[model samples]
Target: MATRPLTGTKVFLILVAFFGVVIGVNVTMMKLAIATLPGTDVDSPYAAGLAYDREISAAQDQASRKWQVNAHIERRADGNAVLQVEARDASGQPLTGLKFAGRLERPTDKRADLAVGLAEAGIGIYRGNAASVAPGQWDLVIEGDAKGERVFLSRNRVILN
Candidate 1:
């Protein structure tokens, strides 16, 4: 049997083919990473910085109010989530006439966030339902507004079975 002689052209072609495969794989991986990126948490970092003082002031106001708010989240057998909030003043009196809203946020993906519209169930009790909540970790954010102004805000991490 006669073996073909190793030539410069063969060596060059081998090198080119090896580098081409590496480059192709790298490009494919880069494109996949970019396509799957979840993006920034905030749209404008400068705007968020500008609002920092306002957020601090709001936090102070909320602290001064000394409101007692309790939130409950329950997963039903139908794979829905039920949220209930009970709010009270510092004096232990039920707070009334406030609009409450709830949100179930997925920590890893912002696109999976779910908004829940809560209605006043009683004097200080607010209830809302979210359909088809998947079993996983979630950030539950509950906000209370009075006369078009936000008065209470809370965020808690929860896990559903």
Candidate 2:
């Protein structure tokens, strides 16, 4: 059998093919990483740090008030997101008379985030409806305030199917 020699053209073709495959795979992985981010819990690190003192003070105040908050997300039948929140005092009494709000925020894209106004159902229960909440992971933020005071605040990580 006559074997072919390792000519310049063969070497060039081999190098091009190898680099093409490697570059293609690297680009694909980079795109995927940008698409699915881990999580962005805070918008601004500096601002959060500056407000750290106030946050701690507020938390202490809330602790003194002895309020407990429970928050979660529910996927509706219509492929929407429902934010549920419940609040209670340390004495195990329901807490009410507060305005409730929440957000279903994506880690990478703020454009895909959802904001909803939660309505008080009964006995410290609040519900909010959101549209087109695609199945994946989400950062849930629940806040309740009355007369310009932070009555309840919660951040919960949830996964949807």
Candidate 3:
């Protein structure tokens, strides 16, 4: 039996029809699934639990005085690093009478503990010198009081290079 060749139009029409049915079914199923799904309130129990966990962690940090210390480092052209630290309140304002001590620490090596105290450089700026810190990572610790209360804090892993 002789068979006529299928035209390009016939193939295109078949492909279009097949894709149309698939797309129609997908759209219908998507609509039905969305309509049947339960609404999730963002302030639900699960969300509240997450928020509570975050609050607890923050409270723990505050109790440990970890939130009081803010530390940073700047490198110079002489391969030396200037570790800058400013004691601050929770609102990030510089606090006076805060003592800061830092250390250049490396794993499996001797740690160099630097003794530095906050000095009034200018208006609301406190600076402490770190002579032992070089171009690498180090830790700067600031410990003192806002208004005669104990504040123990430490900052870690500041990159200088």
The number of the candidate with the highest lDDT is: 1
The true-versus-predicted C-alpha distance at residue 109 of model 2, in Å, is: 2.6
Better of 2 and 3 by lDDT: 2
Off by over 4 Å in 3: 1-69, 91-93, 145-150
How far is 136's C-alpha from truth in model 3 (Å)? 3.0
Q: Which candidate ranks first by TM-score, i.e. highest?
A: 1
| CA displacement after TM-score superposition, residue 55 of candidate 2 (Å) | 1.2
> For all the candidates, what are their Cα RMSDs to the real structure?
1.4, 3.6, 14.8
Q: Name the 10 consecutive residues with the lowest summed lDDT in model 2.
A: 34-43
Q: Itemize residue pairs with steric clashes in candidate 2.
A: none
lDDT of each: 0.94, 0.85, 0.60
**Model 1 Cα lDDT, one tens digit per residue, 12-104:** 999999999999999999999999898999999999999999889988999999999999999888999999999999999999899999999
- The parts of candidate 1 lying over 4 Å away from their true place are none
Worst 10 residues of 3 by lDDT: 105-114
Task: Provide the global lDDT of candidate 3 against the true structure.
Answer: 0.60
Error of 1 at 15 (Å): 1.6
TM-score, prediction 2: 0.68
- A best-first ranking of the candidates according to their lDDT comes to 1, 2, 3
lDDT of 3 by residue, 1-161 (tens): 99989999999999999999999999999999888655543438977987888666755766754344455666667755565665556676766655445555542233344556556565445566555455555555555544555345454666666
Please give the range of 10 consecutive residues that has the lowest summed lDDT in model 1. Answer: 144-153
